[model samples]
Target: MTSIAHSAAVSAALRDGKPVVALESTIITHGMPWPQNVETARKVEAAVRAGGAEPATIAVLDGVIHAGLEDSQLEAMGKATGFLKLSRADLGYAVATRKNGSTTVAATMIAADRAGIRVFATGGIGGVHRGVEKTYDISADLQELARTPVCVVCAGAKAILDLPKTLETLETLGVPVVGYGSDEFPAFWSRRSGLAAPMRLDDPADIAALIRARAELRLDGGVLVGNPIPLADEIAANEINPAIEAAVDEADAMGISGKALTPFLLSRMLDLTQGRSLIANIALVENNARLAAKIAAAL
Candidate 1:
């Protein structure tokens, strides 16, 4: 295992067998504008703490993997620029090369599992892109879920991708998708993706039980909890789908693909929706954090 630097709080929690929720650093470095990104990260951590769990925001800095970040580290990461958007493929490369980088869902999961953390919270997991046939641009996140044991709590696949294909791929991977109080899988900013969730478990304790059951059965993958955005905070599918379509089309036209595609589409969404998308994103991320904390406690 790679050497990991644990923050004081995370070390204490792990030593004491306390609940802890893993958070990703890309949400701070690549997901939003600086101050809000830092502020939202703090709020999400607070939400975890409020739910009776410690927060472990994972990142890689100067050839070291950090299982938890301190306040100053969080601020620096938020303000830093030109960091790699790391996933499974390049996580080790960044560490080996001593480069600063932000961990995406896949990379975060790998790090969390290495640190003995079993739960994570994030805004959404990436999945099959719209043009998976031509581009084959699937995100590493799905594969991570298939092989890693850390449970992930997210709003769902990002709205910019093909939700149907994403769900199909998860099914093929044998990763359980559980809805947290909804039969339908959430579409990131929206409460409904119009796709029925494969399994529904309303209570966090029940979700924890499901995780335990999987462990007992010796399942190879993690569980995904599709947590919907709050009603007041959600941008209805009707209102947001058009913007998503437009942004995806524009990316295709502009020749943006692979790692650049999501950030491009998301930045375009901020412009097209006049920042409503960002507001919803922050809300959903915090919401996932709180729920993840509860699930961690139950576990």
Candidate 2:
């Protein structure tokens, strides 16, 4: 197997046995616009550090798999155009071609596992799209969760996805989904997705214990920690549901398919919501990062 190189700061943190939380880079490259994207990335990293863990934001740049990035790199990536949104299928391709790419949930899990980081924080996980019956579209994240041992913390699957189907798919894959502090699974921009979670965990210590137990049992898959957005920051299901439906409908009408669908829908939602969606996204990501840092510290 090829050895993965960690950044100098990440290597030092790993060597010193400090808590380290893995983060994905797509949110910096493809998820948002410039300035705010870089700003939010820094704030999320700060949140992790405040909760006593080192943040390692993973990405592939110029054929090198970076476990963490410097401020300049983060800024440049946020402003750069034409970066690929990488998953398991194309992560190697991006590296092989020496292209700059942002890590998706699946790619991040793979990188985090290799780096021996047990926890990752992200805004949301991709899942079954609403029209998957015809498009057969599903995110690689579900399969990655089934195989990788790195616990992932997210608000939930993106609100635009088919929540019940996503949950069912995760169940079928034998991946544990734990709703943090609530019985209801959270939607990305909203506090609740109207579906009951398979399990609920109210404490960070208990979450850490669950992860340790899973490792002890030699489980192959990771755990899903569904942390809801703060009520103050949430957009409410009713208000956002219509916007999401309109975005999906527009994508279908335009014949947008495959990997392009997500970014397209998200971009539409950002405009339709007058940028409120982006605000909620940043808040939930920060919330997940803080919780993930605590769990990483405990582990």
| Each model's backbone clash number | 0, 0
Candidate 1 has an lDDT of 0.95
List TM-scores for all candidates, in order: 0.99, 0.99
- Which lDDT tens digits does candidate 1 get at residues 167-206? 9999999999999999999999999988999999989999
Error of 2 at 232 (Å): 0.7
After TM-score superposition, what is the CA distance of residue 7 in candidate 2 from its true location, in Å? 2.0
Q: After superposition, how far is residue 277 of candidate 1 from its true place, in Å?
A: 0.4
1, model 1: CA deviation in Å?
4.3
Cα lDDT tens digits, model 2, 27-111, are 9988888889999999999999999999999998887888988999998999899898999999889888999899999999999
How far residue 235's Cα lies from its native spot in candidate 2, in Å, is 0.5
Best by lDDT: 1
TM-score of model number 1: 0.99
**Against the hidden true structure, what lDDT does model 2 obtain?**
0.94
Name the runs in model 2 displaced over 4 angstroms.
none
Model 1 / residue 188 / CA error / Å: 0.4
Work out how many backbone clashes candidate 2 has. 0
Q: Which ten residues in a row have the lowest lDDT in candidate 1?
A: 25-34
Q: What lDDT does the true structure give each of the candidates?
A: 0.95, 0.94
